[model samples]
Target: MSRNHAVLTALAFLASVLLPAAASAKDSSYGFDTDRDRFGWAIMSGGNSTTSDVEDQEALDKLKEEYGGDDFLFLREGDDRYVIRDRALIERAQRAVKPVNEAGRELGEAVSEQVHLALGTSKDARERARLGRSIGRLSREIARAARRGDDTEDLERDRDKLQRQLDDMEESSRDQRVTVREKTKTKTRSEEASRHLKQATHHLQDTMHDILHDAKARHLAEPMR
Candidate 1:
C-alpha cells in the first residue's frame, strides 16, 4: 500500500540482476531511456519491467492536490501486474516552468532595487511610467534637474540603475514568454509519450483506462504554467 511497496518489490529483483556479484551493496541510482525513480516507466529491454496497480484513493487525492490536475492518468496492461504513472510528465512540467520562475525572481530583485533608488530621491514623478524609459528620457530628467537648480549627480546615478534594471525586466519578460511556449510544447510531447506507453501496453494485450480502480502510484508534482 505504501508508495514504494510495488517499486521495492520490483527493485529487489533489479538489485539482484544488476549486482549479482555484490551482496549487501548499497542501492545506486540507475537511468534508462527517460524514466528514473518515481517517474514510472517500463522499458522493452530487460533493463525495466512493467508495473501494475489498482487505484488507491488517498494516494489519488494527494496526487490531484499536488499536481492541481484532475486529468492525471496512467496505463495498466490488462492484468500485467504493473501500472504506469505520469511522474515523468509532472517532472517535465515543473522543469518547463523553471526558467520563467527564475526570471521572475530576478526581475523582482531588479525592480525592487530601482524602486528604492527612485523613492529615496526627488523623482515623485517616478510613480508614472518614468522609471522604465529610454536614455533620451534620462537626458530630459538631467536637464530638468539643472533647471530646478538641483544637483544632477543623484538623478544620473538613479537613471543608470533604473535603465539597467529596466533592461533586465524586459529580458525577463521575453524569457518568460519563451518558457511558457515551451511548457505548452512539452505538455503535448508528454501526452504523446503517454499514448506510446499505452500502445506498448496494448500490444501486450493489456487494457488502458482513464480511471483505474486503485492506482497505487500517483504523480505528485504540480504542473508549471
Candidate 2:
C-alpha cells in the first residue's frame, strides 16, 4: 500500500481498537481529542518540544515498546533522538483490554442500578435538599478533577481560595432550610443516589484524564491543528 493509504489505514485500525467512539464519529471534539491523545500530544498545546522531531518520537518509542513493535519507524535527528513520521508498526500486538473494559461497564451499570434503587425508596425532603447541595458540590469537584494543563502560582492560589469558599458554602448550607416551593418538587433524589451518580461521573472523568496523562502526553505536538 501507498504511504498515505497505509497511514490512514493504520490510524483507522488503532482508533477502532483503542477508542470505538472515535472510529465512528462524523464530527466530535471528543473523537479528535482521542486521536490527539493516542499520538501522545494535544493539537491545542503549542510547544517546540512537542515537535515530531523530538516529542512525538519519544511517544512513538514508548508505544512501540508497549505494543511490541518488531520494527522501528523513525529517522535520527540527533544523538539517540529521532524524528518520528510513519508510526506504522510491522508486527503489532493486540491490546488486551476487553476484560478490563467489560468490567468498567459492568461497574458503571451496577452503580446506576444502586443509585436508582436509592432514589426510588427514599423520600426525605430535608435529605433531598441536602442531596441537591451535595450534587452541586460534586459537579464542581468533577470539573476540577478533570481539569488539565499547568497552573501558574497565581492560578494555584486562586484555586485554593475557591476551594475554601466552596467548602464553606457546603458547610453553611447544612443549616439552611428548604422552602415549601423546594419541598414540593416533582423529582428528588436521596443523598446516596446523588452521591453515587456524581461520584461515578467524577471517576469516569478521572480515569480518562489519567489515561491521557499516563500516555506521556504532557505536551502538545508542534504544527498543531
Candidate 3:
C-alpha cells in the first residue's frame, strides 16, 4: 500500500479500538433517572459503605430485581443532601411536623379538661383555691413548652397570661375563705363566699379557654396530617 493509504488504515483501526470504550463510558455515566432506581441506588450506596464489595453488589442486584429497571437518577447536590425527583422531601417534612403538631393538640386537650374541672362544679372557697392552684401549674407547663418553641410565641404569651389569671384566682379564693371564716355566724357570709367562688371559677374557665384556643390555632397552622 502507498504511505498515505497505510497511515489512513492505521487511523481507522485506532478509531475502531477507542470508540466502543468512549460509548460505554457515556452509557454508564447516564444510566438511571427514575424514582425507584434512585431509591435502589441510595440503598446500595448505604450498604456498600459498610459491607464487602460482593455483599454490596449482591444487595444492589437484589434491589434492582425488587424494583426493576434502571430509570432513576441519584444526584448528590451537597453533603447529606440528595435530590430525588420524587416527593421525598415533602414526605420528610411531613414526618417532622407530625410529633410537634400532636404535642400541641395534646396540650390543648389537657388545658380544656383543666378548665372544665375548674368550672363544672361549684365548690367551697378552699376547694376552689386548690383547683386554681392546679390550673396555675398546668399553665406553667404550657408556657414552658411554648417557650421551648414547640409551639408559637402567641401560645407562650397566652400561657403566661393564663398563669397570672390563675394566680389571681387562687388569691381571691383564699381571700374569700378568710372572709367567710371571719363571719361564719353571719347569714350573708355564705352567699358572699358563693359569689367569690363563682368569680374564681369563671376566671379559671376563661384562662383555660384562651390557652386551648392558642394551642388549637398553632396546631391547625401546622397539622401533622
What's the distance in Å from true for residue 196, model 3? 36
What is candidate 2's TM-score against the reference?
A: 0.24
Error in Å for residue 210 of model 3: 36
Q: Which tens-of-lDDT digit does each residue in 5-124 have in candidate 2?
A: 433433343233233232223211121121233332211111111111123544554545543533332221222322222222101101112232333333333322222221211233
**Candidate 2 — which residues are off by over 4 angstroms?**
1-94, 97-100, 125-225
lDDT of 1: 0.33
Candidate 1 runs further than 4 Å off: 1-84, 121-225
Model 2 C-alpha lDDT versus the unseen true structure: 0.30
lDDT of 1 by residue, 3-62 (tens): 244234333432332331212332111121121122322211112221222132334334
lDDT agreement of model 3 with the native: 0.32
The 0-to-1 C-alpha lDDT of every candidate, in the order given, reads 0.33, 0.30, 0.32
Can you tell me which runs of candidate 3 are displaced by over 4 Å?
1-84, 123-158, 168-225
RMSD of each: 23.6, 16.7, 32.0
